[model samples]
Target: MDDELVLDPYPSKIPSLMDPSTSIGFLQPQEINLADQCFPRPQCDFFNPFRTMDGSCNNLQYPTWGQANTASTRIIQANYSDGYAQPRKSVSGHELPSARKIRTAILQDVDKSSPKINLFVMQYSQIVTHDTEFTILKELGSNGPLKCCNKDGSTPEIIPKECLQIKISDDNNSHSKHRCLSVPRALDTSDRGCNIKPVRQMNGVSSFIDASILYGSDHETSRSIRTFKNGKLRRQLGPNGKSYLPNVKKATELCNVTYDSTVCYVTGDPRVNIQPDMAVVTILLMRLHNYLCDELRSLNPKWDDERIYQEARRLLIAMHQHITYNELVPVILGRDFARENYLLPLTKGFDDSYDQYLNPTTTTSFTAAAFRSLHSSIRGFIELVNEARKITSKIRLSDFFFKPDIIQKQDNYDSFTRGLLTQKAQEVDQYFTEEISELAVRIPDRHQHIDLISVDLERGRDYGEPSYNKFRQLCGLSEAKTFDNLIDQMDKKDIDALSKIYEHVDDVDYYVAGLLEKSKPGSMLGHTFQCVVGEMFFRLKYGDRFYYEFGHQIGSFKLGQLNEIRKTTLGLIVCITSDIYSVQRNMFEIPSSRNPLVPCNSIPKLNLSAWKEE
Candidate 1:
């Protein structure tokens, strides 16, 4: 009854010769005029204090090095099937394991919870992910909306080049009736520039930790969200008479609203409506902006709306960087590794390590594979907690996709905020709950769903990522010559599972292999991911001239103001912005005996008086 094509997991013949001197192919088949290509050459204001909306002008010589809508960089040479634009293939030109099948075998439901890391860690990671990476998935084709499969759930006779749909075999019990899962290819930099050589995907957001998710990446979105008079963002009245994110008039296209009364909120990123936790964080940031705006206006009465706005923005960004490096990075990479790699912030003075030659553009390895290891930590339900820290109710994560009205209901916002502080996150491992595997991104009315694990696996191939062995070697680990070589990194059971599914050790996918590796001491990530993520954070800090701790730059914060930023923490931000009265000093970790809950006032606060100008 199984119609799935089966092949021997072991290789039967020698791989084709890898040509070293191969010429590169242009992304477009036709020749393009080089002179007509448009590039960003922003006029740098050397003395300006604010960053450009699109992240240009950061580096004086290279204006668009890490700007929005630019092509992502690569750690190693791409391995495209055509050496240009097609998805990557195995060395022997055979199909790799089905992403869905691999998911079923390795990442089944295991309902495990972390010991100390709270739900806020997962929520903040998603926020950080949105800040640094966004690959625009192309949906439309020469026709209207692209559909790669027939109405009867069968593959089309002629598949479009843009559709990289994952084929579901007849033996796939989870999707027995579905033959394929439609996936649109990511947009590349060909339309803007870089029409030459091996194709790379475009990062739609500014590739920096500059809070592009709070303020918009482009000039239009930024200007639209402001009131233009009080250095404040536009807000809406919630059911509890508190200010919340403004609602978009037309959201049926963006949000999956089940009822007419269910409203969709708008923010800097359209993905805010993806879930409840994302919307909660966005709303909290909005409140912090207004709260800071009021304080800045009172302190610097002579300053105009623009000065107050830019100053407040700068301060907020500084706090974000501090919390990310100081609080968040330590937990993921371990305090020791972060210090050894210079990824942690200095406790006292300014950091003078801004390097002009380094490119801060995010690498494809970090985006497509390494950072995705955190996906296993997502819990099935969003728990709601009362003021007493007792779980009151819970909502399934799958039911709330593209629907964020839950936060707008009476007293629910505070309940969810408390929940993030109290609930424990799922442990990082091979297992994923049914909420993520069976019901992720579900469309109830259409009776459709997407397997996130499949999407991740397919995305790596689509981006032409190299094999797991290649990445392991790059990270200074021993080269895996045989499947047994993986024993040092993964358990024997995991290695056996991989050996059964893959033909050779070299054929393993980076995303799959990275997850199976045992985590390092005091860190949540494995050795390979720790290397990739650690390097990225290092570049993000040392390469950006506007980094808060870096002095002597036009955009640099003053020593006094910098000290105030250094005092800021994620817990304090949650406290000052929301109605929650007490939380642990470090919200990234749960309240344990060692890290006890304390009143909000006792926590160190950002002293805005330091920014007072005569």
Candidate 2:
């Protein structure tokens, strides 16, 4: 074959059929098939119905393919800290302020004011995040034992000092053994340290939100949870006749931690048992899938189980993409940024902007730092309400952690679903509720609790994310040379608090600095975070070959189906899945005079007839 011709520029229009070829024996084209040549239809056989399981679109072999440092030599030069350590006390040779101390200082509860955003906004943010990125840390084996502080009266072992959190006991002793291991980074050909690997689904990680959060990423896990019936997932009817995830056998066997209750339901995602809200969202999506399956079966009666399952899965994934782009993303990133970044999908037809060369893998920084910024928006308690918007009861978020059985109780799911709509999300600020700040997961009858803020900061370092200044420069912002530079982005008090822990501005952790910065207008994130997150979603939307909105792809939704997908929203989804009677038109925003709650029947529903085949 002749050497491939590389053209820097080409003619705007193809030569007409009447025009003769410049080269002998060569034919002149009348039109150019740019879509086929540039982005050929993907082979559907390899496509996982649950997710775009193959890494052909994304850089799976090398997940850190598009990072600032991709060269093997550059990995050696990268800075990898054991943990985010505090500045030293010069005289005493002791650490001045600890990570926990800094957390308590800047992340303390200032006011319990709920923001204008609704609870679904917070839930969707977390659900979308869980779908894309999940970084697993290396557990301490027999070799490394966690070190306990002398004050706690527990056996002391050797561990990284920076990983310890000073936990004060009821006896007035400070026990400092909260072990946090560094996340193992991907190794280069020579086995040198590189970017951290996402343990969750990485292939087309951004496409259709990976569905890892809905169906567990592994095939065996997904198969175990699925019923394989009429293309519908298995679900059990609760005492109230509402659908709930089927309970697993010996649930204790699947516990992530010792304190977790063993009696949890088996869902596509194992994290369903991690938190009540997570379970709620997972069950909601599962129900949506079943509902779509039923509709598709009705429309295509002759379709077999496999055909119905694939189409229903396709529609379900499209619905998720639609909600994320149209409903959830606009509220979180603000409408302006959503439009500016091309995150919004067209109302009808296909988008031909899918770039085969673009990698859709989730970034380590995004998973470890930027996306986790929403922790500040989490309320300490989960409220249950009635149609009258009356609060029936409030459940502490920490208390329900890893104990999803509470949602399985009689009428509890309905109450929680109602609460999701009526309740307001915590304000988006540097301050976090005490439940999340100090007592993230409290084991029943156990005195110890995990602090999420500490985990977030330490996780950033473990993932080998660069300092705040480095990321700012990476995101095209000026690197802060002095503490004063951050003043514009962060409050004076937060700046003072950060300075006390970090010796220099360059040493600040990305999670701490980014969360403390002032949020962009109509957004819950700061400029740097918004830039990183916005860019991530932009690539996720534009780079995937099988993106639901794009027409003419091998397995993409039909134009009419895509239009129907655009009609889908979180409000309609909740109404279809749950027993809720009324909801706000824009479920992502708090119910108000402008967006008031209406009867569930009043909400617009997606027309399944659009998916009908003649």
Candidate 3:
């Protein structure tokens, strides 16, 4: 892990905006050839970047490269006169200091110790941000009536501010303020503001994290959440009979009725009821797809059920790209910038760096600002604990948001997999957790709450992104142009509180100066959000050509089934799907004294007899 801590690549002295001699300065090379005509590409001949089954664009030369543009929404609404402004108030009317109050004034949580990883790296960074950012849901008549700001004038002059809650004026008290209404982004043709549609999981608008975590990138929501027998899916038992997940009664009747049953389910991501750690990693990949369809029908006794569900969904997407490039990109990009960006994974194979013009898509500044710099590693509450760690039950990560009825109780999925292997996340720094900055989801029968740091600075200015010195001059760094050249990447009192809500230094905001820079050593990211989330995961693993370590391609993997899916981990997928016996063979680190606590059948598994069937 120390080839002299890697370094060297730097390069980019500015060009990119897809450099065709870069100038469409504020768009219009026929509107960038009409937003590249909504990405066409699809003529597959094996390289199943999760078979978008012709929903189009799976890297046929960067089909609309993860769409959405208008030149980054006209360079973040050209100094706003009302292209959606708001956030800079102060002069005592308050409301000024926000990216959740500079993440609650320079990340306070004073040494609660243990950010020795775990909590499955905050549930696999929200399942790799719902497989590379989705954001489309909000186009029913293109929204409108939001006014809000009542203060007790007893309601009614325009309400539904999506989920309002701003109210800032301090000096001790007062009333009415909640402010939500951001939503509005979906567009692609009916032209409200043009080009937007990169709902991800189309399998190739930059191969949107293709393993939609086990077969789901919309083929009618993967045939209404599959269950054609042996290649099983449709599960449902709970109240301790175990198994769970099959419900979706109209999306659990819009949640919130204080527990016991909103009944939401049917996974493979419709954001499986938004939280409970994304329904415990979509019920631990639907119990590793019915335990690899009963070990591929006991090693194929005349295979069928659609060829054992497309070969156990291609070995569960090569054990989720071998536990995301060998255990979460070397614990978040640090095994020397993931072995100097070959993004490590080739203990034996043909990795000729598959760059079909490197546009594995998802990059609107790494999906709305450096992969949400791990929202300061969450954790305002969600505990459970036991095997002598104690805690019992905690909850409040904003009441498990859209609550999967606290994952149907009765052993609550082995106390949420022993509180994700004895919990300890929160500490990416520049803090957050007041349950995601002041109650991110507190309905209280519609009084409202969600300010997730003003919904992450209004979703990076509703996905226009740009600022933070134009991504520190598109990641070649330098560009600060004074806050004294961002004092070697921030912290002169966060550059004097971002010079009192930024009047210049090109108006700051790229997720509030990439979560106030600093961490880049063994990496918790910083340095232009670790060079734009390590060059968008090194172009999603060298522009993926069905990238499971690319060995002699054609849907790679079979160097002994990619060495038994590189002995799949994430603590051997919670010791082969939950009722957690005992963990810590580095389930994202923390059990100290050289990572102890074993015995989940002493870890290491993935030996599906090199997927049998001779």
The lDDT leader among the candidates is: 1
After superposition, candidate 2 runs with Cα above 4 Å error: 1-78, 81-97, 140-156, 160-208, 255-263, 442-447
Highest-TM-score candidate: 1
lDDT of 3 by residue, 213-261 (tens): 4456556676777888776878888775778778766643445544444
As a whole number from 0 to 100, the lDDT of residue 532 in candidate 3 is 64
TM-score of each: 0.92, 0.79, 0.33
Give the TM-score comparing model 2 with the true structure, all chains together: 0.79
| lDDT tens digits, residue span 1-614, model 2 | 21112221211111111123221111112111111122223443444423443223233232332221122111001234322222223123333345566676676776555556767777888888867654432223455433333334342465443233343334321232443312122312112222222111122222236565666655566677678878877787776687888777665555434433344778755556767888888888888888888898899898888788768776777788888898887777767667756788887678888765555545556666788878878887889887787899999887777777778787777788888877888767677877776565532213455567766765555445566776565544556788888876788988888878777777777778888877766666776687667756875676555578776666667677777788888888888988888888888777889888899898778888977788
Query: Candidate 3 has what TM-score?
Result: 0.33
lDDT of 3 at 411: 74
Ranking according to TM-score, highest score first: 1, 2, 3
Ranking the candidates on lDDT from highest down gives 1, 2, 3
Better of 1 and 3 by lDDT: 1
